[model samples]
Target: MNHAIDSITDGTTYRTGNPEATWRHMRAHAPVHWHEPGLFPGFWSLTRYDEVKAVLRDAETFSSASGILLRPLAQGEDPGSDRTLALSAPARHSALRGAIAQWFAPRNLRLLGEHLDGVAKAVVGDALAAGHVDFVTDVAAGLPVEVVCAFLDIPVADRPDIVAWTTDAFCAGSAEERSLAHLQILDYFGELAEERRARPGDDLVSVLARVRFQGALLPMEDVVLNCDNLLVGGTENVRLAMSGGMLALLEHPAQWAALREDFAHTAPTAVDEILRWTSSATHVMRRATRDVVLGGRQVRAGDRVVCWLASANRDAAHFPDPDTFDVRRTPNRHLALGAGPHYCVGTQLAKLEITAVLREFFTQVGEVAPAGTPERLESIVVNGLRSLPLHLTPRTG
Candidate 1:
């Protein structure tokens, strides 16, 4: 526990670099060890797969109302102020998820299939046309934004601005930058919400604008906040999954060739493996509601517990040869998209997006290799590449 605490306080141990070794060490030695980083409140780390899953499932004991981020809340900032599906308590979270569940139903997602197929074709075609491109911007980031925008009924002209605001809000930004971006996003959504309210349409915004809770239309703030959540969650997870998936494929050519040869059969499994290997949305925190014993350690009431999804996905106890990237790995119940009640509502859409990307890659691109080194996002919150330079060869057929 002392060594674990020392490693965590070093800061680099969690934020940057490959922390798998660090997590592997912690999982073996201190599955539920406490650390006092001094920069913020002391908290416990849950590195083992079972322990992390337990915390996620027992949200009644480990509440998310304290906020999911490990950073301390600013003075006077109400925990519930920014409550969306991810941060809300059980009842409220259920209500919020229920309101939008139909939008992401399998039938609705299937309706978008042709549209998403067109988007994927265009994204892949454009990247190939460019010959050498930043895959992150040129390919990975394009489809999800378009898909979400189409679903939300956002105007085409507004997408670049929305993407900028969302990227700043979710990735890395100074406090003022994030504050300004947040205000801009809210202002845009506020105006859009009013328009949707006045003239309802067959879109997510209209659906949210009309959703009622307790015999009354849901509040505008909740509508806009959840819209923001959908954008951030939908955009970031899929984008990183595809970008990181491409990197993984390039790094393992045999797996890439295997996928390319039998894309129809392997794409789904490949998508799941990519999700496991990337494991973006690195860690989410919860506060202990009362004193409890976890992993043979006493956790005090009101203590913050950080669960590393990235680490859990790589756990050897659960995954066979966890380090190896096997696209056909079966029985893969990885927690990349999370677990239990708060499991990603966007799972179906995400799978579709990644699957499309892979299938399109095999169908269109003959060969893709790294043009230069990919840059890692410096933040610990999301495990993804900041940029990926790739040389592409289009398929002749």
Candidate 2:
């Protein structure tokens, strides 16, 4: 355990570079090992596939409310802990969860998807017309912002700021930078809330404001939380899914070519394999409510536990030749969306967006290759390519 802690603190990007081999060593030798970092409080790093599922399933023992990610925000920083309801206790998490659940329900999402497809088609059309472009910005990044904006009923002019808020809020930002961005977003949402009150629209927030969840109409903070959820969870995950999926395809062009040739069939499986491959959002943290044993170590009440989704996705115990970028791999039970109540609420929407990008790109353009070396995102939580300089050839139709 002491040795394991040293490696994690030293710095390791499990998804990029050589961390895959390093993770294999850890999983085989120490599936559940306590880790400490200089910049952050140490947590238990769960590497094995099964162990991660166990922690995810039994939320009572290993609570999401405990913590969602690391940093405990470094030394001498202002206080930061598990404050978001999404990462809080069951009762508190449930209240916000219940209100948003209806908004993301299958029927509701189905209605959302209808609008989503139109947006997807439009974006794809624009990308194809450009002939040569940076696929991430021209296509992937724009897709979710449009969908999330439509869902929140935010005007098109302000959609870019919504994406900017998430970049500043959820991922990493300076104390001053994060604080300022939070205030700006809150002010924006507050105005929108007022607009909805005076003239309710068909948007989710307007409906949510009128909703009586638990006892009565959900409060402003809860509404804001859901708004924040829509703002963050709504677009970013799908954006990562599209960007990461494109990266995976670039890395494995044989599969990418295969997908391009017959997108109607390979596109769906490509989405699954893409999500499994990316496992963006890396991991979610939980606190040990009581003394418990995992991977042969004892964890006490105050200890933070980290799930290595990035590692688990490539776990040899679960994924065969886990490093291979094979889209056709069957029985891929990778925990990309996670398990239990905390599973991504936007899974369906992500799939649609991903599929649309792939099918449309393949159908409209070809000769896709790296224009320059792609840059990796610096975030510990939101793993992705910052700029994927992909060059595409005009399609001959």
Best by lDDT: 1
Native-referenced Cα lDDT, model 1: 0.83
Candidate 2 whole-model C-alpha lDDT, 0 to 1: 0.72
Per-residue lDDT for 1-397 in model 2, tens only? 4554344433334334555566778888888876654457767889888889888888788887645666544433222233344665777666656655676677877777667677777787776666655665667777777777878888888988876765565433365787687778878887787678678888877866666645776566556656766667666777777888888877776987788777787777778899988877777778888899987799998788888887888987788998888888878888988877677777777787788767667766757767777666656666676566767675776
lDDT at position 367, candidate 2: 73
The estimated TM-scores of all candidates read: 0.92, 0.87
Backbone clash total for model 1 is 0
lDDT of each: 0.83, 0.72
Please state the error at residue 180 of candidate 2 in Å. Answer: 4.6
Task: Report the Cα RMSD per candidate.
Answer: 2.4, 3.3
Query: After superposing candidate 1, which stretches have Cα over 4 Å from the reference?
Result: 1-16, 73-82, 167-182
What are the per-residue Cα lDDT tens digits for candidate 1 across 1-397? 3654445434355446548877888888888988864655678988889999999999899888758767743343333343677887888777777978888899999999999988999999999999999887779888898889999989989999987886676444466787788789889998999899989998989988887756777788877877877887898888888999999988998998898889889888899999999998888889899999999999999898999898899899999999999999998999988888888998999999988877788889987778998877766577788789999999886
Pairs clashing within candidate 2: 65-87, 65-88
Displacement of residue 133 (Cα, Å) in model 1 is 0.9
